[model samples]
Target: MSSADAFQQLVEETLLANAAVVALVNNRVYEAPPPKGARVFPDVTFGPADSDDADADCIDGVEHVLQLDVWAQDYGRLSSAKRIADAIRKALHRADLALPDPYALALIEVASIRAFQDPDGLTAHAVISVRSIIETET
Candidate 1:
């Protein structure tokens, strides 16, 4: 699989397997979907990947910059979204993700996290930036 697809799969699987995250979002994590219902609040959405070649003279690998967006509807506070974001960070940061036999995920790191109030004033949004290094199978 492409690095982006692999990275996204890793994130989705990780979040699904996290009890805290599942409790927060009601298991409503998606790759790309609009906010739908109360059960979907405190959800996570995966954004596109920005990948670059990290090949060396004797090694074949790729470095990917991935984005995960956390969303929640909370007035006067962003605690819900922040909590989900924190869980995501804890689950992914410095993680050694497993990929298909065709590829190896070497590392997953949290690059940055930024939270903001959406224009609606009731939607809490947080963008988490992550870096993943993958070694391709020979």
Candidate 2:
């Protein structure tokens, strides 16, 4: 699998297996935002990702900047989304995680998190960014 694909898979698995995250989203973590009609609140979806080559000294690698969005609806607040975002951060930040056999995760960390209400008036969204470096296993 491509590095980005493997990275997402690693993240999705890590989130799904986390009790706190599962309790909040209940397997609602998706690689992409689900269709609008099928979306459930308090979910985490993979957002935009930027991957750039990190090759050096003949070693192949990638620096990946990825985002996970937390969705919730609490007309008066963003607390729920915030909580989910925290859980996601805890589950991933500085955590040692395994990738597919072809790849090795060199580092993973939470970059930043932002919470806000969508213009729709009822949707609260939290965006969590994660950065990681991955290298192919020889």
Candidate 3:
């Protein structure tokens, strides 16, 4: 699998295996936001998938920026969304992620996090940005 794919798999697996994340989202983690008809509140979804070369003098690597959207109902504040975001941050920030062969986690850290009321008016959304540098054997 491509490094990006392997990295993403590792991320999803990590989230799924995290007790706090699983409890917060009830394991409702998805690659992307599910259709409106398939809505499940208090869920997590991937924002996008992108990668760039992170080649050093002696090592070949890839840098991936992952965005996770944590969702909850906006009853007035972002309390629920914030809790979910915290859970995810604890799960991934500086995590010891294990990628498949040819892809090893060189660095993993959580970047910015934002919580807001979505345009839909009833949804509170938290956007968490996680950056990872994956060293590769090539």
TM-score of every model versus the real structure: 0.91, 0.92, 0.94
Lowest-scoring 10 consecutive residues by lDDT in candidate 2? 31-40
For model 1, the run of ten residues with the poorest summed lDDT: 33-42
Candidate 2 residue pairs that clash: none
Query: For each candidate, C-alpha RMSD in Å?
Result: 1.8, 1.5, 1.2
lDDT of 2 by residue, 15-134 (tens): 999999999999998876678787778788889999998887867899999999999988938999999999999999999798877898989999999999999899999999999999
Error of 1 at 76 (Å): 4.6
- Mark the regions of model 3 whose C-alpha exceeds 4 Å error after superposition: none
The candidate maximizing TM-score is 3
Best by lDDT: 2
Of models 2 and 3, which has the larger lDDT?
2
Instruction: Specify the poorest-scoring 10-residue window by lDDT in model 3.
Output: 95-104
Whole-model lDDT per candidate: 0.84, 0.91, 0.87
Task: Score residue 91 of candidate 1 by CA lDDT.
Answer: 87
